[model samples]
Target chain A: MKLFFLLTIFFSFVPILYAQVDTTTLQNNLYDILEDATTDKEGVEYYDLVEYLVQNKIAVNTASIAELMKIPNIDRQSAIAIVRQRNLLGGIKNENDLRSAEGVSEELIDRIISYLIFGDVKDVSFFDSINKNFKAIDFTLRSRGIYDLQQDKAFSDGKYYGSSWKIYNRFVVSKDKNIRVGVLIEKDPGEKSFNDFTTFHFYARDIGFIKNFVAGDFLFEFGHGLTLWSRYSISKGIETVGILPRNGKGIIPYLSSDENMSLRGAAVQFSFNNFNFYTFYSVRNLDGSIDKSTNQITSIRLDGLHRDSSEVAHQRIVNEKLLGISADYSFGEIGSVGLLYYNSTFENDFQHNSLLDPSGNSFDYFAGSYSFTFGKLYFSGETAYNKISLATINSAEIAVDKNFSLLFSYRNYPYDYWSLHSNGFGEKDGTQNESGFYSGFKWRTSYGNIYFYYDQFKYPIGDEKLPLAIKGNEFLIYYSVKPFRDTEFRLRYTNQLKESVAAINGEYGVLSRRKDNLRTELLYKLSKFIQMRSRIELVKTYATAISSEEKGLLLFQDVKYAPTASLSFSGRIVFFQTDSYDSRVYEFENDLTGVMSNPALYGDGMRWYLVARYNTSFGLSLSMKYSELIKPNEKTMGSGDTLINRNVDNRLSFQLDFKF
Target chain B: MNLTIYQLYFWLGADLKFVKDLVFSAAVKKEIGFNPSIRLGTEYSMVDFFKLRIGTSNEPNTYSGGIGIIYQFVQVDYAFFSHPDLGLTHQFGLIIRFTKN
Candidate 1:
């Protein structure tokens, strides 16, 4: 295997050429401020709660307010104004006293003041709290490997079956305030089972009243998710109003290595004093496409690519079952309420060849939620229903203070609301037959912040291109600035129109298209080890009898270096041009570390990537990335089994993060 | 014509109590196309357990080092930088001071 991948990169650089490692410059700039607040397939549960507060820190003078809302942009009115300014200034002493609390800002204490810390809160004994819960047990082993060098046509017609590299592995054992266990394995690159997917889980927390407990896999969200949610959700970004409510941290613990969003069996939660309860049960084995003399099941393969032989005969071929329950109440400050129920089933039977599919074997859901905070306004909401087609959703949020906030949502679904874990707040993709009305806002000023939104949707059974019943509307605006103190700048604009079904004059009607976008960005911190970023984007599209107009442009530049402090480096150089792909453009990069890439700049050449990280004072940490995507007049690059031959496309990845 | 001089020092080392001594630096370049860069660094500490550093830099040349450690309130650091034609670079950091008044 290529000399065992060069002897595993020479014994992983022989322990970084002989020991010497330790890094944390505030958890590597808080993972570059949560990777610039996520994008591109968002959701990493805010980088897993800032990597568990950079390996357990918090304690800004004795935290609490649920430990400052577990960090990410602290909301709950900035964790009740940072515990009411640490009890009226008798504490807090840094990050300018959390920028003098009160709705805290200054980019939220500069992205959580490096995982916080600020003194006094010790005292523990009983074998030092069981040796700090056995040193908060944590064991991680991550591996990533990738290599792709041209040659396409499904590996020259051999229809690939393996080899071309791409492997991933994960193993975790947690215990930082509870307990967790994980395992994941993957193989792709023509998959031929070098372990083509495997996952495992076990979790526990606050055992007394059983506040949480899981077994062999999990994930389930309630309220606000429209019915049931699995797999981190967060749509719309840039903290537009601190993520418009939806603090549903119900039954979690499914360390992503996504091979079909969680749920395998067992789940629990319970509490007494202010009432809380939850329940779950699951059974899975999906990856469908049945239909052999009507055993039904046609379709239901969420990308877990099994590579050849009809995707390995549609792997597992259907079998799913789920059940849930929930209840909650807490009238502490005149708020908190919830109720939920869920059900799902399937073994086969679900074959609807068109007419907008959606034939079933069972499904049900119901929901209600609320959250409040009166004086100074703060409210939250959720309302779901979907007893096979009664589909509905209603969301609300208001924040009226600390610089304005508002959000309003409405959904209808219908068109036979079928559920497979509906993720709501829709515009389609599993929230059934669409129906919408959204409104968003955030103001805050004194040099930065202003977000806006407007949405209006429809699609009541519209298929094969507007067979009638379609509508759309959208608008977005953003503006941000700092202009100083480590610099920052932003500007955004968007407008959408939707409604499609082309081919007039030859039949097939429904028009309206119209997209528009404009963006600008800048971030600077040319010191403390240099950092810089720049971006410019533009996209335009119009269609309705195709009257010309289609444009796209992208620009990028980034550089990051950490001359010392255990060396760091980052690089980017992109330039895009689009006159098609309906004016494509997307940007978000800086990978390796739970990798994610945005790349979607159409046509005209130029792309780049270079990343490096190293830390090995024996507790391994290695990263390497190299990317390329040129296009000097395309020559086949992605189609079918991910085609690629010439027209340049390159990738090389290697990652390892081990800590003991 | 270009000239540069820089110096900084701080000491307390009675077996490293704390330190940050760049001490002295000099650079000279008679521009024709400019290529004059130089640097040097140093650090040492005690109170919080450990820290050690070293540095070197020159226009298209480089060399660097780092180390830091502390336990019971965790802290970790690592560094490495070397380039003569773009190569070596590494970094890692972690800190956790969960209270100490």
Candidate 2:
């Protein structure tokens, strides 16, 4: 019985220990409150008394003895007495009400009222006026300065210093209503004087009906993002996770948090009987400096999705004022199918076409994919086809692709989501786009993963006269394992072959190259706030007779340290052996109409850079980078110097981001 | 003093933004200086996230401003400034902070 009583005592003490207060901070706040009430004098520190009162509304009535003691002037004995009195006499309602309560006085109320407030008190109407409803706003800012160095080599070789800043804001106007806005600014120090700005606007549940709208710059995701899409900061540009491009400033509907696909302009959506329908009309008008090109055409997109009894539905859409319609459907035990059609007039001619005549073209496409689980095995396959052409050409180009994937495993839950996709998959942000069968399967233990995969991409030229055609295939086998809680290691080998078509002697010729790439990486978490990562990439490429040897090894290391909730520091180093630039200039006849030839040389070189960056919650970031481009055993171009040199370059930048 | 602090920050940063406004005054004045104004501005973000904001400080105060966005401790804020004639006379700026969600 004594042991049981002692155990209970220990447990009760744990709660007491956790509830301790910092007396110093309490005393400071008390002094601050007293000082503010007594003096409106300048130089006397002015804490946000109003905001502080609003923030601590609930603690006044429900605070524990420890919590009460934390309030500036309240001692432990007074705190306990106040609690006891409050329990006996309900709770104090107002300043005057507190004056009559036991252990409370008018003078004490006067002193504390300056610093604290109770949110539920309704006797006075002033607090109600000040805080009609709760609302929040959030933002990011960036600024960059640029200094131009050398520009002889396509400006790509120029030494430039730059910086950027951005601020994003989200306003929760109410429980169901929200407004989001953001601004971005950029400065290019390398360019002498250039600045950029971007802004965003958003409204969720805008009409109180079953509708939502977001305007400004946002992303849009159509079917798997193959055609229309958007993705944002969270993930790198990889197709496996099904994200599209991250666009900006447009109005869109809110489907869910995962519905990051946003469009600019006016969007309206309605849901009826398990079927959802949406339509949006958008205008593309923004500052031109951000991107060199602009879209002048007005666009309209419509979508309809439905499912029987179940909430899942098939989807369809028609987009762009000129483009017609597209449709998509899916069902359990069946398959998912998509069809798209578009017809539009071209505003610009490629070369010989007459601008007055205008080319009207139509494209038809179809995509189908299916997946199912069989005991411990899963199988899936997808196929797509597209036919596009100009009516004037009288001939349409067609392209088709198909893929099938299969996996077998035990039912004992042997893997996590990331591991089941093999180590090839990066982070998942719900917006990732899936191309084809990209990953195999694997098992996961505390030690990480064992896996294999094959990836292939082909950009086939439907028109034989087109200037570019690329086909690439990659095969890989890798293992990723974390032997300990804080360490992660990955070892992988990949063999890739690429083929491109180029015009030679007025005829299309194929140039094929193969490379064996070996990669390894290790990430170690030294502590909760510090992490270290190191990686190496080795590439060996063969180009038959011209050059049998073209190989290089790249090494990179990065250390990230976060000492507090608002600040982080990172340092990275990248070193690689630069390839030699072939001084020989090749002239290629125009593939279309076999016109006059143009000559260009592929430069061979190496580059190395190191960058250190610091980020803070106060809307500021700073970075410094030093880079060098080197040419070894040079070859001259014409009568110029042995090699156009790029010496060591240094750049430093700072940015601040916030929202209002 | 606030205006002075703001201008000093911009000058030390060597911000080169151009502005068009310098003063904004309402037809009437009360216990609180409350008014509405329209502003057109341009700004740039540095590589790491610093901002150089240049624009109309007011209808009459065209002061260049240095701005930064800070998001730490789950709170976000923007630091910016306008002209002294409107209020802070030389060093006063605006710091707006809030939580979005």
Scoring model 1 with DockQ, what do you get?
A: 0.01
lDDT (C-alpha, whole model) for all candidates: 0.68, 0.34
Model 2, residue A504: C-alpha shift (Å): 6.8
Model 1 over residues A347-425: C-alpha lDDT tens digits? 7778887666767777677878787788766666676666544665555566666677787767777766667776765
lDDT by residue for model 2 (A1-660), tens: 000000010111222111111112332233323321211121111122222233334345655443353343432223444666666667655555555555443334554554444435432222342345444333333333333233323233333222121111222222312333433322222222232222345544424344345555433333322233333221211111111111111123221111113344555444342223444544332111111153221221111111121111111112222222343343322223333333322232212132111122232333332333233232333222333211100001011111111232111111111100011111222211111223343333445555454555444331245435455666666667766667777776767676656555577666666777677766667678666655655667775434456655444445566666554454443434424322222211110010111222223323333334454556454544333333232332222311223332333333333322
Candidates in order, interface RMSD in Å:
23.6, 31.8
Output the lDDT of residue A396, model 1.
59
Error of 1 at B75 (Å): 32
Each model's DockQ? Answer: 0.01, 0.01
Worst lDDT window (10 residues) for model 1 chain A?
Answer: A1-10
Which portions of model 1 miss their true places by more than 4 Å? A1-79, A82-98, A102-146, A149-157, A161-226, A233-287, A298-300, A312-333, A336-360, A372-419, A422-527, A530-560, A563-624, A627-660, B1-101
Q: Report candidate 1's fraction of native contacts.
A: 0.00
